[model samples]
Target chain A: MTIGADLKQCLATIKSIEAGLSSLAINTNAEDEQRLYHEQMMVIEEIKQDLMKRIGEVEREEEQYKGF
Target chain B: MPEWIHIIYRGVLFLILLFLMTKLLGKKQISQLSFFEYISGITIGSIAAEVIMGLDNNIWHGIIGVAIFAVIPFFVEILSLHNKKIRDVVEGKGTVLIKDGKLLEDNLKKEKYTTDEILQLLRGKDVFQVNEVEYAVLEADGKLSVLLKKDNRPLTRKDIDLPSINEKEPHTIIMDGEMIDDKLASAGKNRAWLKQELDKQNVTIENVFLGQVDSSGQLTLDLYDDKIQVPKPQEKPLLLANMKKCQADLELFALATDSEKAKRLYAANARKLQESMDVLSPHLKG
Candidate 1:
């Protein structure tokens, strides 16, 4: 698969993981576990954002190449 | 031979013979033994006791009695091993005491188990309610095997689509401040590697009360001094953090580059790195 496709797949996985962590944070009763899950969700969110930005850059470059 | 000397010799001989017989019978727990095995065990013990304490001068009689008891069971066990009929007769079939949340009254009567006894056994298996059990069998060994109803069963990793992880048993490489060379070898490691790991943690082997190499090849130490806390291994997490940093650096490079080709190259590599991280994140992530 192309790098853009790979990035999109990674973005989907990150989003799912972030959602899972969010669910875990909400479902758990312990304060420490909730905090840990929330922190992990935030880290995954940052990665997801980076992945989405890179996907956009790759797709944009591919479009420019097609024009040439 | 004097009376006391004869008794001592017989006692020592029977003890050794019984020990050998028990070893031949295999290492099954008492609760797991068949009816024949149980009877043989008790009979042999009683005969051994009788022969040891009996003031009679016939030592050959006691030896022959013990031999007959041991040899017969050994042959019976062999027959039971080869034939299903002998096995079933020796180890009676498990009675289905409960099926589909309903108690089999006839089977309970045959097994001479009261409802209260069944309930107590179910409680032992952590099942307080009868309707929660889909099936309950009274095994020949008297163990109650209860299968919970699908709705009542606890959720497992497979139920939630989680990948199964098979972990190997951890090897105890150090015990009482002494290194076990064989255990270290079993874990596929050596003295040089162990020394490097010990040095990395700044711990001396003599100070470690117990040291284990886990399935992931990480060394965990229990120091003799309780006040000192050893740091946990962070190799996987560290590698994950490094990958994230590299991806972020690439993204920064992509943004700073004036040329469009360099921007494309950096962004493409960043995405590739992210893909690699995605595959490893399950194992690496806390």
Candidate 2:
């Protein structure tokens, strides 16, 4: 559970949620309904991007603790 | 001529004529009948009854009268289809009893509905207070349509910005062990897909009293056999909280330990758990 490992796990969890939202969007055939599900996917994507930014910050700090 | 002979002949002839007349009329249920239709139906039925019972009254005269009554409504229904003004005249326009929380006294008096009667209708719609009513329309059928004030109204999905739900209706796939072909076709699914779903649930068509497939692909089966397995609801946030508690313990252990290697290992596990939980938090709130 190093910073690097933790960031990967965080990224994985967010990716799974994104995948679930994507499947929901794809399964709905109606254009309006697909749009609605994509809205939720968009919200989740925003969160995933925020986590990715946080991961970059964590990776920078991991340089300090690499030997320890 | 024998009285019994006349009774039987008139009764049988009128019954068949009544059946033919009603069959020509569209399949509008009693609730859907407009004021003109209701009166027409009653008049036609009364003429048929008079022809059957009144021994002296010429049956031909009664038949002609019944035909005229039926014809008028049939023509009126046809005319109403093409003319909106004629429809309004025949069916009558809905009168507004309450608008913007104010009682339209003139309209209510014109409709011959008293203050207490209007209040009763409002209460029937679950609006006990007059101030809560935004609009109350008295329809031609004498039924009241009440819309509550915006502030008093129940919340809709749009109010909270919830995503629009699937508009496709649930289709009955199976009923009484028989495949409903029309419903299945409407759902855009075939028998093979239905069988696979039933097989996934370990249910056979013979045992299924009813089966419906929703737009979300959720299949609901009701078997002739009363026994059922209800899915237990998940313990969601509680499960998350317990995991969080375990992570907290790992963090504490990492802080208290003397060995740097052991500390880093435990702390790393803790950090991973913390990140997973952080990612999960917003979903739990939503």
Best by lDDT: 1
Residue-by-residue lDDT tens digits, candidate 1, A1-68: 54445455555655665665565456344455456556766666666676566667667878732211
* Deviation from native of the Cα of residue B255 in model 2, angstroms: 14
Among the numbered candidates, top DockQ falls to 2
The clash count of every prediction, one per candidate, is 0, 1
lDDT values for all models: 0.76, 0.72
Q: Lowest-lDDT window of 10 residues in candidate 1 chain B?
A: B28-37
Question: lDDT of candidate 1?
Answer: 0.76
For B1-286, candidate 1 gives per-residue lDDT tens digits of: 6889988988999889889877877775244467776777778888889988986647788778778877887888789889999899987788999999999999999999998999999999999999999999998888899999999998986888765544467899999999999999887778998999899999999999999986556788999999998998776576567567667766876887677976886687678668756655654563
Model 2 TM-score is 0.67
Question: Docking quality tier of candidate 1?
Answer: incorrect
Candidate 1: residue pairs that collide: none
